[model samples]
Target chain A: MYDALKNITFIIFDLDGVFYRENQSLEGTKEIIDYLNEENIEYCFFTNNSNYKIHRYKEKLLTCGIEVSEKNIFTTTKLIEHYLFENNLDNIYVLGSKQLQDTLYDKYTQNSINPNIVILGMENNITLKDISNTINLIDKDTQIIAANPDKLIPVKDGFELECGVLIDIIEEYTKKMVQVIGKPSPYGFDTILSKFDKQKSETLMIGDTFETDILGAKNANIYAGWINSGNKLPYNTLDFDFMSFKSLIELKEKIKEAKR
Target chain B: MYDALKNITFIIFDLDGVFYRENQSLEGTKEIIDYLNEENIEYCFFTNNSNYKIHRYKEKLLTCGIEVSEKNIFTTTKLIEHYLFENNLDNIYVLGSKQLQDTLYDKYTQNSINPNIVILGMENNITLKDISNTINLIDKDTQIIAANPDKLIPVKDGFELECGVLIDIIEEYTKKMVQVIGKPSPYGFDTILSKFDKQKSETLMIGDTFETDILGAKNANIYAGWINSGNKLPYNTLDFDFMSFKSLIELKEKIKEAKR
Candidate 1:
């Protein structure tokens, strides 16, 4: 698996369509993962989808026949938790799943007296009730932070809800803006870059989303490839360079050939 | 009620904190509504909270001891609907309330062939699935539209969600910004003025939200009032030349006085 990317220290792969499109693995995903695994090359799954907590993805990837451990996974959920924990924020009202609440349990419980911070995540059960609570808290000068600004998520049964929707609800309620922390955001990418041993020039960022993956990598001055697995293309005037690949495997083969 | 205001042909009130502050009624609310009812005056409720459809607010207000007919409502919802309908845009995927959907329903239902426009509101029910559908349709070239872009909603139950959140989510999904329709938007205010017989003068706009209401009135060259609500004492920084009033009874008493 000595690929054209042999010189790179890390390869950040977007989860939804980049690694696996919906249910079926993207063409050549297994081989590439196997190759990366065989070489012991470290890569991070960089996604803006903060709906599910960190560990759920590793198991799902295993089901997709691409083996990976929870330790290897990197989601916005973990990123913001780190941000809050390091900043000494104890109170958090999560606009996301219970898994996220569990992830921040005890340490980041909702503060009744003096709230410290707010974390935005995916909430399957988001109601006007949550919106009310969030708006109230934010109005009370509580700091609001978002795991990711991604408004949509690609799910196995078509696209389900994601964190940004709840973020929208809360943002509108309080008329206050929140900070974003995941992929496409410099926060997650900076984390990957800091952890990565290679320079940005030699690495490749493979993502199916042009906004997050393609543009996000370019924002880091990295080589970005937009895999058009969903067969959708951007129509706006974007000022970034990107490679359009039909699938991840095709790009993999190109990488291998370049190495040879 | 007659102490301050006793002169005016038009009655404009802020939607949220000044009027009813959501499901709960604020102080002096019933007296103000009753005073307006007792007098033959024309008044409109203005809001920047683009959360529910305007009619939903009508329903919400009816339940909250305010006797506001749908005709007395002037919102970004109706403003945007008029814009879309005027441009012959009927088929729409609104990100707002059922009121917004209902507003465009007639125009779209009449066409009943292919939806042409999308009206995004401050939707708490926003889902990633809904975003996906919105993106897919936008990819197919449906014109994107929104009511207003006020980011926060100050509710009586505390602060509520606003419209910018929905715009943020949809922007990530579609990668396309929408045509905004409400206050702080000159176009939205212009649409409202056109609806009424106001010539930017001889008319006054009323609202509690200074960001959208006062600022938007200034942009539209319309007179406005900052609803002090017996709270917000010492009201400062108005975007337009505005009168400050505590209640609608005062407004009616003044309007009658102005006519005399």
Candidate 2:
């Protein structure tokens, strides 16, 4: 099918509710992955959910019937880790799930007071105790950082509560806003672009929503294939032209048609 | 001096270049407003914005300084004008100034296709003749309406062109976005709220900068302030809480003392 998807070298996939919601598969996701693998249509798994480590994300995707290595997945958690490692941060205070805490342990030095930064994620174990430790570090003039500021994440019923709400509540108390590194932010895109040398126009960013996917593409000036499967219109109108598709199978056919 | 200020019963002011920038505003604004004038403050103004005919936004303070108009002096050009007056609004094409034209004139009924809503204001006025005849009722439509985008207001270095630019340019092309009423959109807080028991605490708001003093107030919120003088920051953090005094004089000595 990618035979007609000529010149197209990179395919980006959104994790969580888009490709697979939590532990379940959303139908033909495997077929699309298989097609990409067979066609050498370089693809990367991208997720804004920073609750898990890269391997964990890989494991979750595999459970959903796809396979990828730690290197093949890009999470905002890793992006902040990259920034931290290159800058040599020490004694970080975390605000996230167990998987996120483990990710930092895989990369850095031991914890200490008056360290470098405060990193936040979805802390399933969130407690007043956790908030106290985080705020204490922040009060000591430590830089506060986050995986992203996206307030909500999709759930089966609807959007499950996510990170930004936590960020807002904590920020109001600490009087410090977290530095974010995810979608709509420059950091996440930087991670993607650095991994591939393919032309942007030849690379199609197919995502569900316009505010994040379409707006991000317009800001970066890339070929946008808006997957308007959500049946939504933007509050403010958008400027770039986009092609909407129902499914990956249909998208493959459309690409084949475009190539001809 | 507040002893004298105590006699000043009502106040109304503008919003744009007043409490915020053309788009953004100062930080710590809401924090201050919420702190003071939570009560007893009645009558606030938001005069210079809306280009809309006043209605629905009785509660959308997230964007601008104030959201209350217990007789707010601001106007809504978009809301339907209440009157034993005129109605006939159809076939009116809005060229530009969405803030005003679409928000304000979107609801006028015209006699024919002679362009009822000409919609004009502070804009670059890029294309006029393109739809002027249709709007001005030149060949078809009846009445004309303009959005309150802007003409070109004075700012820092030179003239900051606004909807008027579009109005001027379009007149040559489509003949202006449509001109109904410019400033003092229908719900002028000054005009409507002026006849009341207005106080500072009851109607206080915060904004980042100043463009339009939307209303008169015992309290206003913004980033900039001058005392018949130049822009000045009295201290490092903030001087007063909710009250936005463009001039130290506008704010009473007792208020200043209270702030300290």
Candidate 3:
């Protein structure tokens, strides 16, 4: 595990589970950040969540006692913005959080009649009628894009429906493919790599979820680590090899030992 | 086509497209009902909708200038009541409209902690949090039941999500099968047959939708007729033979012609 850490010059961390879970910072969150800075390792935070603005994530990291430049944070919203800019796409209709809608609408025209793109994200109060209206807005030429393909995200009580459920409903109804912009898609990973000028072999992704984080790294052809924060692996993951840590403290210790 | 209608002693009519669209009665709605009464054929209105009570449907039919007893109405809500009575199941958790919840809870205990059965129905204002709360209440032993398996129902503007989407999300998440009690499953048809003491060969199902109305009749081993109320057959349905009419007037003419 220590040997695997030696060549990792660039580290991408999943914010929700790895560093903090729902406003509480996990153990060694600050220590790991300090260690990375002292060792001159390039690091950034990446999350599949598009419900909040980039500034909210920056504020969340500040609460964890770790502060970083806004440019080092990657949310699905940011990646989608990058995609739209790259493709020169406009005339958007977003079915998502107010934060996401406000952010995107500030940059692009909000077209409900016939949009060039339909962006789906997670929201708490989405109704069946709202979904119907969104579906009605799509024409044959309309493009569909989703924040992430995560069906559910763990909450304090139980799992909450995610953006993937919306994607499932829309895609199944329309018989059209939705381009996903978050983890496990390689779009966000490639964007990070290109922005930071990092090589795949030298980059490591640390996350708690295997589906989005670890499998995402594999899909992007990068080093992966699983932070076992009491979340059980959904299946037997013996087929593939990846570094596993019981907590962020163990990961920090491993990095220290690797330097020695 | 007239020959097939000669021996039909019982008729099951789908309400939404056959009788009315929204609140407006379709062409020949009153004529068909009057003709059925004149022929002394037993008939009833059956709808897959569980969002409304039987009295609401009774009133809606009355608006179409057809008066019928409440006993002749079969909504999914009534069928679900029959299902619970037949199985002697109680302690329910309902994820549906206020009308559905109130109706079921009036007869059965509403157990949110650990329900004996989770009943799913369609509602306009259901939120993601509501769905998550419902999913959390289900244990390994909890039985899941849905009012219908219709994915989308055509509305005035476009299609609205139905009970089938809820079943899709819940079944996919829990890896459990949901017992569907509405059209295309034969449960509702079986209940209607048992109530009317009618045989399959002597029964006829007339509706506008192909998937639920036509396919359901075929599943129940009854004669099927498509009303063709401006709703196109979704696929090439040439393999199986069923009677088709452009309007309810045509169906009334066919019945009169057959008797003559």
Evaluated with DockQ, which candidate comes out highest? Answer: 3
Q: Give the per-residue lDDT digits (tens) of candidate 2, residues B151-231.
A: 434455333444443444345434323443433233233234334544333333323232222211212321122222233
For model 2, residues A47-99, the per-residue Cα lDDT tens digits are: 77777667877778878788777887888888878878767777786778777
Q: Lowest summed-lDDT stretch of 10 residues in model 2 chain A?
A: A152-161
Report per-candidate DockQ.
0.26, 0.02, 0.83
How good is chain A of candidate 2, measured by TM-score?
Answer: 0.81
TM-score of each: 0.63, 0.47, 0.93
Candidate 3 local lDDT, A170-234, one digit each (tens): 99999889989999889999999999999998999999999999889988989899999877897
Give the better candidate number (1 or 2) by lDDT. 1
Every candidate's lDDT = 0.67, 0.52, 0.90
**Alpha-carbon deviation at A135 in model 1, angstroms:** 4.1
Better of 2 and 3 by DockQ: 3
Off by over 4 Å in 2: A1-6, A22-24, A110-112, A124-133, A139-141, A154-159, A169-177, A231-233, B1-260
**Candidate 3 CAPRI grade:** high
Model 3 error, position A109 (Å): 2.3
A1-260: candidate 1 lDDT, tens digit per residue: 23436576567888877666656665777888777766666677877765676677887787667777676678887787778866777766676777777777656677644567777777656654465665566645788888776665565444555666666666655668877787666777776677665677667888877767777786777877778776476687286667767776777676666656
Chain B alone, model 1: TM-score? 0.71
List the candidate numbers ranked by DockQ, top first.
3, 1, 2
